[model samples]
Target: MFLTFFEPPADGWHVRRDDLLDRLSREWPDARLVPSAEMGKSEMRDVGWTYDSSEETVECWSAQSGDGISLDGDEGMVVQFVSWFRRLVPREIDVTFCDDMYSFSLMIPPGSSPGDVLRMYSETA
Candidate 1:
């Protein structure tokens, strides 16, 4: 599995890419957290809605996993997990699952602090 974290902007409250990767490395040492190539660039088009004013942008991270082809959970279970994860942190973090990509976006409140949102997602075996 792969993971990464970002740092806060030099002049803004946004989290920077390097900081995030560093944090993730400490948090999940076993995981290969790489510097996202899409950082500072608009890679994935925004196709969703957010309610947080602090979240200024989103980042994309990719990895190769042959574990399975589908996420092992029902819709309700996924929603509950996401809701609980959001409450643990102050910033808004949304996760998206596509064909082969698991995307997460950090939504910052207008006056929120700088840091990547932390949340746990589980897949059943």
Candidate 2:
């Protein structure tokens, strides 16, 4: 799964993640999207939402936005989330996702035009 974060543009409105997900789903019914769920019963370090797959689950934890919990080894859900999220959020928001031992973060960087991030993952059932 992939996780993307968008710092509201100076002129853009600020919307909660939940609301964002809902709007995306409504606008794109074909997109497999949902608000990430907090990791339940798993003791990982990191505070962020989770996305899961039929075989594995992946977790995306952001130190800046996350509560500082670590989500290691939950690769499946994390990958799934990231992939679905990129397809949902506006195509102009920054995002991140974890894959294997590395994590990919998408950003517009400083002084760049508003942008978005996209991460993709694939797993067999």
Candidate 3:
């Protein structure tokens, strides 16, 4: 899966980065930090995740607007990660999802539940 977080404050994002990484580590011990260079950037870090199910890849990159998180892992695990991520979004943001089959986009308005967003993505794609 490919996912992007649109227009998130770069500075504000750092505050949540560690905790999120920690949670991912606790959940998926094989999970590890992904280097930004490998992510096609040199500034972003602590923004990748991996699990046992997939081909052990965690791709990420930083843009002027926000961050990107991509996984070639299990869809269910990615959905859980996305659900936990909702709390870290401070405002509405554009999210895009893509797979081999289709790509979908949606605006995650403030106060919207991540589960709902996941559901929408699932239903659409």
**Candidate topping TM-score:** 3
Reference-based TM-score, model 3: 0.53
54-115 per-residue lDDT for model 1 (tens digits): 32322224222111112223433333323322332334332222222435433322232122
Instruction: Report the C-alpha displacement of residue 97, candidate 1, in angstroms.
Output: 12
**For model 1, what is the error of residue 123's alpha carbon versus the real structure, in angstroms, after optimal superposition?**
17
Q: Rank the candidates by lDDT, best first.
A: 3, 2, 1
Any idea what lDDT model 1 has? 0.29
Predicted model with the maximum lDDT = 3
- Candidate 2 RMSD to the correct structure: 8.7
Query: For each candidate, what TM-score against the reference?
Result: 0.27, 0.37, 0.53
Clashing pairs in 3: none
Q: State the C-alpha lDDT per candidate.
A: 0.29, 0.39, 0.51
lDDT (Cα, 0-100) at 50 in candidate 2: 38
